[model samples]
Target: MQPPAQVPPVPPPEEEPQELARFREEWKAELQRRRAATAATQASSSPPQPASSSESTLPASPPAKVFVPVSVSQPRAGPSKNVLPETHPALNGTERPTYVSPGLGNALSIYRQAVYAEQRSDLDEALLLYRQAFRLDPHVDRAYHREEMLASILQGQTAAVKKLTVSAATDEEVEQLASNLQNTLALSKPVSTGKAVVTGTLASLISGFPQELAFEPENELESVPIKMLPDELLVLVLKKLDPTSIERFARVNKKLRVLSLDSTIWRNLVSKTYRPPQIPDIEYMIPVIEKHLSDFRRVYIEQPRVRFDGVYIAICHYVRPGLSENSWVNISHLITYHRYLRFLPNGQVLSLLANEEHSPQQVIPLLKPSLRMKGFFLGNWHLEGTTLHLTNLIDASGRFVLQGLEPPSSAPIHSHLHHSSNTTSEDRARYVFVMSLNLRSRPLGRWNRLDMETYESISLETGDATPVALKHDRPFWFSKVRSYGLQV
Candidate 1:
């Protein structure tokens, strides 16, 4: 069979109304009339010729009229004749044309175009526009952000907009308003007023949730079980949990956060951690809590307390001259050592200094006082503000000796050398060491750093106190020890 021939489609039966055709003709004639009138006005505005005998004899000629063609198919809202169209150079005479919107001559507008293009997934166009924007103004991003923020603020404040009427503001005026608003906001920061402010992504997300514990039923007909628990009972249950556990529980929901931030829990933990039987009252010892907005959570975070569930370690290094087989070049060795400090809740602290031969993993587990390791020292710590005072420091290893010191004599002439004639070797060896350290939170919330400020050794036999130098000491960083368990 032969292939079927193609059929021509019929056009619509609708015809142009006579009135519409007449309107179109009138519009065309009006455009022509306006164009002719414009040309006549230009001719009249031309400069007159100079009057001369030879020039006056010749008749004056009319000025030539220029009529530029206007495309009827183009949109009427396009750029005016005086505005130049934006164009980009072609690559290999094969690249497609990219049309940019008109009136985007400045950096801010170009940056906005770039952002719009990026949102539409036009990566190539966005990159090109971004380069153009930065080339024109380096701070276009900041200007754009400022304008956007001001626009949002104005849009939100209907009453203020009506009162101040900034709709007619120029670009410079808008910028000035934004700057003034920023300064005013900075100056009007909220005072503490004893109110605790919860900040962070999680806090903001849960802000609108109910403060009371909320439980959803598994079925529409079933009742929730946790909704019956009273706040007092819940608080008591939270009290039994450790600080870390309570924090983890609080992260479950907003209700738990409010319960975790209860003044009783944090206040009790703070008192138990800081106040001992020896120091019945710690008001003078710790910083004033009111300054921290009287918030127990803030006080717990900002207060400097020696942690017992971890070891504070300081690693030190120094260059030492090494013995060389050859007599030509002197060799220097870098010596490494670590100092460990473990504090107890009863005000006792264990300190030990070990060489690099014994790594932290090998030495930290053997840091107990019962082991009596070499260089192990037992001391008592007292806290006053950020400063920590360690006194009555004595050798626990029982191997330390004070060299180059003369023994006690029965004669009264050399009594200054020793406290008494009956001073034993053990008494002479038991030199009382005193160390002062400044405590600081490295990242401003965790109390995990200690800096050595002063060290002194007091002779029990001679009653002479000598200052010990800390030339090679480093700041101690806290490392949690699982064996020590939770502090509270």
Candidate 2:
């Protein structure tokens, strides 16, 4: 066959549009020229670099970054219209940014991390981090608190600020506010005190009711038995009811509401119930009632008293290092415990400390000195102003004595060494525990939280006192126990 007419190899069809190919080629050429010009400029203007010394003798500096245009092996056919070219110094090579190594460096940040560890019960880690933070900056805690306060402000959490403002108000401002509150209450059509809603002002509401102990029957034929009682007899009957009973009776009608708010009945209630029977009613306590400006209702509501129909509970947690099977791995166990305090009307208080395995429901019924739970102790308690004091602590059964803090100074030193000494263990275990706690309310009206201020073991024999550490202890919060009922 005649030699195939030489056919020129058909060129591969254009992989991309002609416009795109031409633009990409032009870009490549422009980049090459720019690089060449930059190199030339640097060579002409820059001083020659000195020869590096021996690597072992001189510390080597980090390699300087060279600006190089990236080349695409498979060139993009086209650029997306939505995507913008890199312009930020952080994104492109226009500027070299300083980089911090990945680690905790700021003291406030470290302190915050320590607080998180503490909340998680990682005690050891928390302690270490706390020390590190304090060592780095002694004021780290204040800094963290400032940051938190700023954040709260920015988040519109102004409750704390409002409280601060109220506390900081001048005496005149406070008086003015109180006057305003009274005027508002008096002018309002109705007043709600949770138990009852009274329509109109107290004065006007009472005016509509009969002043004398007489009631007009709803029906002409109906007989009202309560209308027969004289005002004096009626007051005596009301005074006999407890404060709670009187409040319930007040919800019956407007006449009963007026009788319930009587200064005399409330005054009698305050006198009878304010001080615990264990504590003598002192002359000074009278001034406390007078401080309410003769408003016995205010005194009755504001006076602090321990609740007997409930228990104060504290939940505590700690972290303990555990024995690990693997040497390289660390093991930790989170141990949770609870503390309970039940007060009896007789001034006897029962205390118990139990583990997480015991729920409150299971523990509440047994939270008496009679049950003799593992951590049970009995103590006498009394309230003074806003402080609750517990003293004369003895274990349940009243026979489990405590170890003496120290021997009496009058005793011979040799007697302590002799095993057969006349000194008995009972006499040596004569130390009494005394705890003072400050009472606070979580909400405005309820006196429900107890924060330990001081705890001491006083030796009756030696008269020496030793303070107990309360670092890890939490505040006790009151929880109502219906089983206890209204004992006090």
lDDT of 1 by residue, 371-432 (tens): 33446666556677778777545554433322211122331111001122232323323245
lDDT of prediction 1: 0.54
Please report, in order, the local distance difference test score of every candidate based on alpha carbons: 0.54, 0.53
Model 2, which residues run further than 4 Å from truth?
1-259, 276-282, 326-329, 397-430
The TM-scores of all predictions, comma-separated, are: 0.48, 0.44
Top candidate, metric TM-score: 1
Summarize candidate 2's per-residue lDDT along 125-197 as a digit string, tens digits.
Answer: 8789889998987766544543443232222212212323333333343233223323222222343332223
> Model 2: how far is 30 from its true place, Å?
99
> For model 1, what is the alpha-carbon lDDT of residue 353?
73
> Where does candidate 2 clash, by residue pair?
none
lDDT against true structure, model 2: 0.53
**What CA RMSD would you report for each candidate?**
37.5, 34.3
Q: What residue pairs clash in candidate 1, if any at all?
A: 419-461
